[model samples]
Target: MNKKIRFSDINMMNDYQEERWGYRVFELAVTNILNDELLQKKFPSLNEAFFQKVDEIIAPLQLLLYPVISCFSKDPDVLSQWRAYADDGRGFALGFNGVALNSMPVTLLEVEYDQKIQIEEMKTALLAAHIRNLESGNDFGSQFRTDCQLIGAWKVGFKNSAFREEKEVRSLHMLDVCVDGDRPRLVDAGGEALGKEVNGEQVGYRVQDGAIIAYVDIPIPHLDNAPLIQEVWVGPKNINGIGNIVYFMSECGLKDYAIHQSKASYR
Candidate 1:
């Protein structure tokens, strides 16, 4: 059967259950061991052919979309925190060790910030770096050089600026477990009800692409900080080695989304 594992954020969720989930679409796909036959029957393409029931590509059952943030290594401290997280998967104790950093290889590159930006506004400039990376491609920033997934992005920056750096990730919130017993009910990334709650009837949104769009503004303590109005697609870096079962958003796919959104809003 052509089963579409639709996200609760954009579907009827006809036979779903009542509960919260903490994982991304890619993660869930690996967890469920998505059925390859069904997936190919669903989303067939040249790109779709490359994905097999393997380490990175499983059976293609994941059905949620997340943002991919671009990371800019501009400061020593920022790089250090990222290294710590990447090396030990202990991101300031933020439940962010989704990938086993020690087992996999890492490549770090550093690019300079414009001296014209001024040191005082360095924080703001950094935020801009992330936004620019996501909205546009970062020709001036460091490269991740690997396919990774973004898991948790809820963090504080500035002195801990590395937390704000854009990274790849592999999961999101939906039913980590089958809630309805027969079929799993997917919810928003935050686990909010996808549709309006009612005893006999219900009301909700079904626009898949109309999922929630958030813009976070974190203020930093500094002098040269520019007025940052960031609309970046922030996601976690999906490193290698934590589990052979992990999957994540492709960098190219995310860039397409970011570029489309930027043109609609800014261009």
Candidate 2:
């Protein structure tokens, strides 16, 4: 009932197929840029300094900024989703307004499950950098930060092809690991740090599945003080009926929101 959205650390995700794939994708992109004969021929000016600078940008991206993920899906009432994600059809799927939800300070991306598309996106970003360098000449450093940010978000959105049916949309936010306990810390390009966070969103911890999970709560904003939730679908195996669920929703401060029981016959 805190009226906040929780984005948990990607490290806590149970999807082993996608774990550490972000860093792997970035590394593969770097290797392709350096050794791919076609790309090497196209961007001959990409010297050691360019890669060194990229390495500098990636270090902090890998270590300092922890990727936090909040996942949503377009489908609200799929049987597989209910069986796999909803405690075997005993939970609920929250439906949120896409426009209002994405207005928050995070990169919202559609999850790509095709391996070929994932590889191409990484390669395309590298080629885009080459083009920018050609236009800007020696000023490529100006775009490195933005490039890293794109890579950070892009790298995390690729999932295994098996998950394509989920049609997941993920909100990815990078949290600085160096931030002071309860106080925000900023690290400069030269590695200097120590500063207060302007927004004051604090990190929290919870124990899940025998492991400690770290997350940050983003305060949900109400539009004209209206409820942000659009609807919720109760799972098929949920023991509680709609009446009790409606009462729970009221206690959670939601009003006039539509609630539906899962149509799946799965028990």
Candidate 3:
């Protein structure tokens, strides 16, 4: 007989609490890097260094749908949906150290100043912190990488045609995470066999602590119609570690309407 599982039986709070410890440390590092008085004084209005660092760290993960922004709809439903996506097991938290940085504020700030000096400074600082943390044996990013390798791979994109049209018209963006050296491969949620394709050339990356880091920008236009992404299977070769690979996928929606409203009010 199969036993029933209840939400009470699951320790969701404990899970989040445990993850928050590492997230807090990372956050502190990011804050220090971005808010450095010297850095700010040099850049004047925006922090370009900080934004650069953020991009370096996140760019590899291929999760962000758009550049960081601030303006966001106050709609509770929208916020709730975002929260659910972030909390979902197949969300960004599982990988990248369980630190889910909301794109709303970042995107707003970026567009406000066209990702000026301040944003670049912030990105640089964040990337520095991430590298430092990794080299210093923090293991947060490393752990997340390991988790991602185990979970395999998955894909994410929009569903409704209207959403896709709006996004394309407004230049909607998405990211893809490819592991296991450089060979291009695709798999479904059920671990079923799909197809493979060879890209131009494979760039070599160092595998540290059984984790490899690489970056690529693959535009997935097909995903615009189907936004529902549950899980993914990373290729076998990408699964470097002994245990399972943790897969995480996320899509960022640019609130063009919100930005338009903000501009209109200011005008």
- Which one wins on TM-score? 2
- lDDT per residue as tens, model 3, 1-267: 111111110112212332233233334445665577885666443355434444354434423121111112222122222333334222221111001112111111111112233334434544555455456565546643443322111111111222221121111121222444875532111111113332322222344456553322221222223322222222212323312222212123311111101111110
For 1-267, candidate 2 gives per-residue lDDT tens digits of 887778887878878755567667666767766777776776777656776666577656646676777888989998888988889999999888776676566778888888777777887886677677667765756676677656765678888787888999998766665746776543321111122223536767899889988888776555665567889888999888778978888888787778888888886
Q: What overall lDDT, based on C-alpha atoms, would model 3 receive against the true structure?
A: 0.28
Pick the lDDT winner. Answer: 2
Per-prediction TM-score: 0.17, 0.82, 0.20
lDDT of 1 by residue, 129-223 (tens): 33444444533333211121221111101111223343322222222222467765433222212132212112123343555422211111121
- Model 3: weakest 10-residue lDDT segment is 2-11
Q: What ranges in model 1 sit over 4 Å off?
A: 1-57, 61-177, 188-204, 207-267
Off by over 4 Å in 2: 17-19, 29-38, 46-52, 179-198, 225-227
Which prediction has more favorable lDDT, 2 or 3? 2
> What's the C-alpha lDDT at position 226 in model 1?
24
Mark the 10 consecutive residues where model 2 has the least summed lDDT. Answer: 188-197
Candidate order (lDDT): 2, 3, 1
